[model samples]
Target: MSPLGSRVLGRPDAVQVWRNLANARVNYSVDEVRRPSWNIDVHRTALPAERPGPPEPGGSWEQACRLVRDYEFSPPEIVRALYDPAAPLLGRDMLLEARFHGMHFYCGVRVTGVVDEVRDGTDRVWGWAYETLEGHLERGRATYEVVKRQETGEVLFVVSCHSQGAPTLDRITSLGWRLFGRRTQLRFYHRCAARLRLFVEAELRGREPLPGRSPAVGRLVWAPSDTRTHHRDALAIHRVAPG
Candidate 1:
């Protein structure tokens, strides 16, 4: 069983360790920035192409790959597609598959599980359950918005909720240091696109999100820029519309 499973199965020490890790806080510095194009190149070489099989029945590997590509380039498009009751089964299936695979949309982190509570007129809120490979479940939530362009009918945004977790924050920052050999902090910038790609692909493929899967991967080609950073910051400032 996984460490988290072990703890849930009655390992007190494991549970305590998990809690301790979750509560710890650490600080990270932004060492550098890269654009999404650059980050993508880095991720392409770093992340292996070995993909897992898709879910049964309606799910297929090709469909999963398409979902990943679509969501990666245009989150709002995927979200809009899902809102369609008559959309292909692949859309709905991919969402559920992503949850099981430990992938978080937009951000490049793994989620343990997700509960969607979207209603008419309300922004969709997904209660994301997080767990470490060792079986530690940390608590977190994410909200999503589907933005549309007024003039072109083009989808512009799929704004996501801000992520917060004492344990997760610490571990991810620690990972940045360990992997980059610098005290790098995590940000919602384009620099993370490479890392994000791997996780996103994994989610589509119905596999658990594994960090450091491509430890040697340099960086994403399309790393975030000041403009993109500001965009995310702006979105953070606005409240998600209620469902």
Candidate 2:
């Protein structure tokens, strides 16, 4: 059920895509990526937060955290998330249907790690990271985190990633990636970071979350801080009707 003139993946197609992507191995060697090399590109950005100190239960911080977990922070202009509704975010597999210049590209990524901890009684942090799977256009890992300083209650949405080119058998595709991939990747990060900030700020003011190209399914819970696992249920976001 793609849109007219666009290759938008539907639920059934997404389900099948998930099956294939889940089995693909990481395109790059994790061990090799750890080595210092100029070939890798690194990026980081800090998103704005409302106040300083631990966020109130069911408040903006909590709400924003849930949104991040569900991968809803990504602007639909860049990527479409295709995930299994029954799965938990921590280890979820996703098919990212990336769109640019009226063309579509598909890639796979999976949650490789999750962090939930307090640092020296001063900060509470929660985050997860994902890595590119086989056949992906790029090879790398990205980490996203929401951090709240206990003393000041300052919350920040932070994004960081390291990426490099995936070996391509074709010369033309490889050249194209070399010329434009980094620019596109940076743009995606910037937009998504900005979008998340907007959503968090709106939730803090009890205003409606801004609408755009992104689509989410099922009911959403705005706060994850109130109950430890509440947001996990909200992460069950599949667009198809239940059987």
Candidate 3:
């Protein structure tokens, strides 16, 4: 038997304190003791660790459209960067992939083909035709635009998607001849516009600050006027500290 009670008997002050206690004579028995279980140390083999599967390759045009629509801002920059006249066409595929990956944020319209027809002096007529795989067909139009440029081939104005039906193609061709003396940069404009619109919409929704603007500009630009008014009202309620 362990001498647990005798361990405290050596302190005279503790013994005196215990003796002065009211009703400190409670008693106990050794029947409460139990044996320890020593047979429960069995080991088992560990299960294999789970690993993530490979990233999904976005393959469908619809998937591409969704990616473009959902993408925040970066994909638009990629599209704009690809717009440079000097950039090789290989970047177009990359731009396409960016659009596909960011479809939920950007317009998921795809340009299937662009044709440039040049006639007269400096006047140029361009045709840009695209379709939205994700939106209603009524909302999507395969459009042709008439572009007028100076004699130096500088684009001055654009008549975008003004006409309808198969006959509108011929009308667009005629209008191009009437507006500009010659066709110079037709196909380029069509491709550039489609890609640029996606980029612009994405940048706008993501509240990206314009070039040369502070990062806080995004907050200012994105905040609605009503929100600003509400914030101003809230701040007006605070007391000004003595300066």
Candidate 4:
């Protein structure tokens, strides 16, 4: 057991500690995700879009689909909105940055799942979800999706996550989570969803989307490991079973 485990009891592994920061329910099915009994807070926001006269030959939702596929919303300004973006995708792992209630956090998450052509009716949805490797202030997976309804020719962006405050050694971080973490988290989701919609709309209109601007305000801490053992599991796409 690590020294940190002595304080928490039984949980001696830092890697396990990081993983536990996310809500365990994240690994459950999409239907389970929509269930009313999540252990942590659940959030959903419909991204607004103009019909724009059917999709552009190939598909109306193609533009939005590309945005989500390329991770337009995962940038520094979108992590928590008031925080920073990820370090970059290297192997199956990524370094994530964020600020909350005046504390800056530098963490890591492993790409756990990627959705490709996860079909819902005539709509095709694709996205990815990442789990905290270590250093994250919360534990849980956040999945981003771009869905196109073939019948309605509507493209929608959706973001969902199940998370709770992680056990932290920092006094301020712990206090901050206890006080305003949940509220701050919901705010991040709203802003990120809005930003994603703006980007998609800009692309659909043939206009370059402006980058979001948010000042970094908080502490800085890097993950304990510079790199993790590569995992083939990262490339394996976990497709949702059609209902």
Query: Per-candidate RMSD vs. true structure?
Result: 18.1, 9.2, 35.5, 11.9
Q: For candidate 2, write residues 1-243 as lDDT tens digits.
A: 111111233323444555776567766776776645414443444444446666678765687788788777887666666676567877778777565553356677888999788878877778889988776667788888888776775677777787776664246446666677677888888887887888777877788675442333332221111112223323332222110
Kindly provide the TM-score of model 2 when superposed on the true structure, using C-alpha atoms.
Answer: 0.75
lDDT, candidate 4, 83-143, per-residue tens: 1234333224444545443333445556677777747546667777776543456666777
lDDT for each residue of candidate 3 in 1-243, tens digit (9 for 90 to 100): 111111121212222222222222112112322223111111111111112222123311222222222222222322221121222222111111111111111112334445456556444444444432221111222343333343432322232331111111234333542353112223333443444344344443464323332122211221111111122322221111000
Query: TM-score for all predictions?
Result: 0.24, 0.75, 0.22, 0.60
lDDT of 3 at 159: 25
What is the Å distance of residue 60 in model 1 from its true position?
24
Top candidate by lDDT? 2
Candidate 4 lands at a TM-score of 0.60
Worst 10-residue lDDT window for candidate 2 reads: 220-229
> Which candidate, 1 or 3, would have the higher TM-score against the true structure?
1
- What is the Cα-based lDDT of residue 240 in candidate 1? 12
Candidate 2 Cα outliers beyond 4 Å, as residue runs: 1-12, 34-53, 210-243
* lDDT by residue for model 1 (1-243), tens: 122221112112212332233332212111322333112111111222222321223222223233333343222211211111232322121111011111111111223344444334332222222221221121222222222222322221232322222233234333432453111112322333343455545765678554221211122111111112123322221111000
- Per-model CA lDDT versus the true structure: 0.26, 0.63, 0.25, 0.49
